[model samples]
Target: MNAPSSLALAVPALSLKDIGKHFDGLEALRGISLDVAKGEIVALLGTSGCGKSTLLNIVSGLLPADRGELRIDGQPAASFRDWRRIAYMFQEDRLLPWRSIRANVAFGLEAERSRRAERIVKAEQALRLVELDGFARAWPHQLSGGMRSRVALARSLVVEPQILLMDEPFSKLDPQTRAQMHQELLRLQRFKNITVVFVTHDVEEAVVLADRVVVLEPRPGRIRAIKPLDLPRPRIPTDLAVSEQVRQLRMAL
Candidate 1:
């Protein structure tokens, strides 16, 4: 075999090659191939039932593809075998009502077999990462929607995942809070160099948050369009370019 290219040496954080998925005779995705580089944010943009969430599940390894290949960090997905390197955040906060915020954040670490003391330390650090340290002892029901989402994000980050898969994590938040979470998410992703692939139906959300917006075709979704955005950081939604990009993406869909 020839030597690997220098480009290949810089392995993508996650990759899917012609991945397909079927559920109960329904084709959810087909010929899905994409790549996410470390420190990049990519969004799967489409309407409900377009398999955006299904694709996210496959990338996170929570759901298996019926066909095609996968690779993580330049290694075969099956052979790489370190699930700890990936973390997922869903639309629901899914925090345990009985557990404290600190405990909820530390839950995954426990799954990783981290020691109680160490789990607490890392969970606190993760909370700090999301600016929720003061709320560690609080109960899940005590938080606002945005705060709960922050806790969920901290939970995902506590394990130090190299890739974060979000399934419309901010979808339930109010408009203003959703915008704030978008900013915080970008800041955290940049600070941690964590690769992110999130699914969103909201066109403006995709334009505002993703480095690239991938529009998926409806039912048995396939890549419809991949639009790269070069907006400046702390993106202004009302900016002409942003408005135009959103308009274009809406048109694309």
Candidate 2:
């Protein structure tokens, strides 16, 4: 993949300034500030109740921060008109049982009210991107766990999002399948040059995939440390350097 252009490096794909969120009387997130560069892969690493998912929700425009500002592609998120440029994948696959794999992949386009033929074409392309074109007509229940995850990923990518937010999307997969998904995600991200900010508690996963890992502390979750991983690609967990990085991240958490 080519290096990010100077202009792309200049403007952040996602920016949060002193972001704060509250639920009832408890503060979920506080003083959270971050900038995700275009085509960069960032991981939010933390234990439960550390607001990793909460922060993702705010970035995805599903929840509003009580204080602070959010900007997408250099514009204030509240005023950002190109919301279609963002797509989110939650923890669960969340594929509708009733819909075929192709239909499920096309679900995101429903909000745009596109014609059925156009949605079908785009959905097919997305399935092909995830290497699941053959299962287009299959039901969600007919696929394996890993295949379902790819379908979920295909659903997210069908919209051609510039920024993809994931909330522990592969946490449920077995170790081997999770590793495969990690590679798949990296390949697609490189191909699409999509900026990614994903929430993950696994130190190894974060170290393996992130350009930078933002560790958060619980109880009004706040940034504890930001570690940039400058390691080489295809970072195997068994490798000395990669294992050391994972060890350090685990210590931080």
Candidate 3:
């Protein structure tokens, strides 16, 4: 595997070989194969209803594929396993109205009371990671859309998952906020060395953030094309090199 950095050289975190999924009579995915190295950020780019989210769900164990094999660090997907190594952030913030931001972020850590103090420290550190430190006491309803998204990100990171599955987490934000969050996510992913498999309908966003951009064909989705993006980062959206690459990718779509 050609990892961008040495930190990404661990065993494959997640792998899907000939994975297929069907919902009732509708086939959602067909024979999809991919691998996410320890710290790679892979983007699945396609139009709406392309089965990217379904594939993500299967990998996350929220859903089961009807055919083929899925594995986590070489273990078969169907085996009883520790799923704590994977974290998911959906399009919606999914914050708890009853819990404060700090409490919500710390929710996952509650089971291990033997290290409550350390968990609290980790929660605060995660909040800081998403630049939401001072808002720890804020309620979910009080935050702006972007801030709420940050809180969601903090919640995911607090668990220190080896892999993150993000499903258009910033799609609801305004354009400006989305751009800012993109840069922030790049920084966070770099610092944490977490493998990320993100589903986005935006071609430009995929071009900017992915080490490889994969497009799935419509209904009964299957991998249509896999394009490697060798661009240097931090990517500037308006920069000629980046813009041209994005245009070409969109054209291919």
Maximum-TM-score candidate: 2
The TM-score values for the models, in the order shown, are 0.95, 0.97, 0.93
lDDT of 2 by residue, 133-173 (tens): 99999999999999999999999999999999999999999
lDDT of 1: 0.88
Tell me which of candidates 2 and 3 scores higher on TM-score. 2
Q: What is the lDDT of residue 165 in candidate 3?
A: 91
Candidate 1 C-alpha lDDT tens digits along 1-253: 1224478646777788999999999999999998777777899999988999888888878788999998999888788788887999989999999999999999989876657999999999999999999999999999999999999999999888899999989989999999999999998888888888999999889888888889999778899988888887778789888999999999999
> Could you tell me the lDDT of residue 96 within candidate 3?
93
Q: What's the true lDDT of residue 240 in model 3? A: 93
Each model's Cα RMSD: 3.3, 1.5, 2.1
Better of 1 and 2 by lDDT: 2
State the displacement of the C-alpha of residue 81, model 2, in Å, after optimal TM-score superposition.
1.5
Q: Write down the lDDT of every candidate, Cα atoms only.
A: 0.88, 0.94, 0.87
Clashes of 2: 0
lDDT per residue, candidate 3, 188-219, as tens digits?
A: 99898888999999987897898888888878
Tell me how many clashing residue pairs each candidate has: 0, 0, 0
Q: Rank order by TM-score, top first? A: 2, 1, 3
